[model samples]
Target: MILTLLDRLNRRRAWLRWGLLAAGLLVAFGLPWTLYPPVATDIVCWGLFAVAFDLLLGHAGLLSFGHAAFWGTSAYGTGLIAIHSGVPFYVAVLGGTAAAAMLALPIGYLAVRRSGIYFAMITLAFAQMVYFVTNQWRDVTGGENGLQGIPRTLPGFDLSNSFVFYYAALPVVLLGLLAAWRIVHSPFGRVLAAARENPARVRALGYPADHYKLVIFVISAFLAGLAGGLYAVNHGFASLQEVYWTTSGKVAMMTILGGIGTLWGSLVGAAAIVRLEDWLATAGFEATGLVTGVIFIAVVLIFRRGIWGTITHLLRARAVAPVPQIEPHLEHDHDELQPTPTN
Candidate 1:
C-alpha cells in the first residue's frame, strides 16, 4: 500500500513538471508582445546567465565572484570574430564561448583547489587581472570606446531588427535551458549533487570531487559565455561594462534571490530584476541603485526560499504530504478484527 502511494506521487510529480514546462514556454512566447523587443531579449540573456551560474554555485557548491570574466571574454571574442571573419553570428558566438571555456580551464584548475571564500577570491582575482589586461589592450579590444560595429547577420538574412532578433534568440535560450535541465537530471548531475552535499563522502567513494568541480566550472563558463556572446550580438557592441565586477555581483545576487540551487528559479529572479531595472529607468528614477535594493530586499523577505523556490516547496509538500494519524477508535475498520476489552 505504501509502495502504491509513492508510485502515484511520483507520477503526479512527472505531470506537474511537464505542465510547468508547457506553461513557461507559453508565457515566453507572449513576452515580446508585452515588452519592448530589446528588453525581452535582455531578459532571455540574463535568464540563461543565471541558470549557468546556478549550475556551478548551486549544484557544484562553488561560489564565484568573477563570472563576468567569462561573460566579458565571450563578448569580446564574439565581436572580434564577427568584425573580422564576417561569419554567421551564431558561429561567432560559439567561437567566443570556446574562448571563455579555455580561459576557465586554467582559472578553474587553480580556483577549485580552494573552497568557500578562498575559491571566490581566487576567481575574482583572476577576473580582475583579465579586466585590467582588456582595459589596457585598447587597440584590439577597443578599450574604453568599446568594440563596435559587430554584425548581426545570418548570411542573406538581417537580424538588425530588434523584434526579429528576439525571436531568433528565444529558441537558442530555450535550447540552453533544456541542456541545463538534462545536465541536472542525469547520472553525472547526481554525482554533482552528492559532491555538493558531502565532498568527503564522495571522495571516500572513489569519486574525484575536485575534477568534477573544475569540469563544472569550465562548463559554467561555456554556458555563461554563450549568454555574453548573444548579448554582444544583440547590442552590436562589447563594452568594459561587461567585464566589471558589478556585472558578476548582479548575476550572483539574482541567482541567490531566485533560490540558490533551483535552475528555473534563476529565470524567475532574472525576470524580476530585469523588469524592475527597466521600470526604474523608464520612470526617470535617478537613484536606481537604492530603489532596486529595496525591491530586492522586499522580494527576498517575502519569498524566503525565493519566489519560485517557495512556490515549488509548497507544491512538493502538497504532493507527498504525510497521511494524518487517526485516533485508535477511527483506526479500526467496520469489518476488521478487534480485541474485546472488558470495561
Candidate 2:
C-alpha cells in the first residue's frame, strides 16, 4: 500500500511539473504582446545570465564574483565579430561562447584548487584583470565608449524589428534553460551535487572533485557568454558595464532573489528585479537602488526560501505530507490472537 501510494504521488508530481512548464512557456510566448518587446528581451537575457550563475552557486556550491568576465567577454567577442568579420549571427554567438569557455578553462583550473571565500576572491581578481585589459585596449574594445553599431542580422530574418528579434532570441534562451535543466538532472549533475555536499567524501570515493568543479565552471561561463552574446545583438552595443563588477553583483542578487537552487526561480528573480528597476526609473526615482535594496532585504527576511522556492516548498508539503499519527495504547486487547510457543 505504501509503495502504491508513492507511485501515485510520483505520477502526480510529474504531471504538476509538466503543467508548470507548459504554463511558463505560455507566459513566455505571450509576454512580448503584453509588454514592450525590448523589455521582454532584457528579461530573457538577464534570466539566462542568472540561471548560468545559479548553476555554479546553487548546484555546485561554488560562488563566483567574476561571472561578468564571461558575460562581457562574450558580448565584446560577438559584437566585434558581427562588426568586423561579418559572420552569421549564430557563428558569432558560438565564437563568443567558445571564447568565454576557453577563458574559463585556465581560470577554473586554478580557481577550483581553492574552496569557499578563497575561490570567490580568486575569480574576482581574475575578473578585475580582464576588466583592466578591456579598459586599456581602447583601440579594439572601444574603451569607455564600448563597441557600437552592431548589426542584428540573423540569417533569413529581419531582426531590426523588436518583435522579430524577441522571437528569435526566445528559442536560444529556451535552449539554455533546457541545457541547465538537463545538467542538473543528469548523473554528472548528481555527482556534482554530491561533491558540493561533501567534497572530501567525493574525493575519497575516487572522484576528482576539482575536475568536476572546473568542468561545471566552464559550462556555466559558456552559458553566461551565450546570454551576453545575445544581449549585444539585442541592444546593438556592447558596453564596459557588461563586464563590470556591478553586473556580476546584479546577477548574484537575481540568483538569490529567485531562489538559489531552483533554476526557473532565477527567471522569476530576473523579472522582478528588471521590472522593479524599470518601474523605479519610470517613476522618476533617483534613489532606485535604495528601493531595490529594501525589496531584497524583505525577500531575504520574510521569504527565506525566496519567491519561487517558498511556493515550491508549500506545494510539496501539501502534496505528499503524511497523515497525523495516533499514540499507541498501553493495554492489550483480550480478544487478540496469541501465538503458541514452539517446542
lDDT of each: 0.90, 0.91
Candidate 2, residues 93-152, lDDT tens digits: the string is 889899999999999999999988999999999999989999999999999999998888
lDDT per residue, candidate 1, 1-343, as tens digits?
Answer: 7678878888988998899889999878888899998888989998999999999999999999999999999999999999999999899999999999999999999999899999999999999998998899999999999999998979877788998888888887888888888998988899999999989989999999999999899989998999999999999999999998988988987887888899999998888888989999999988877876787788778888887788889987877669745567865475447565422
| Candidate 2: pairs in clash | none
Point out the worst 10-residue segment of candidate 2 by lDDT: 334-343
Q: Cα deviation of 148 in candidate 2 (Å)?
A: 0.5
RMSD of each: 7.0, 6.8
TM-score of each: 0.92, 0.93
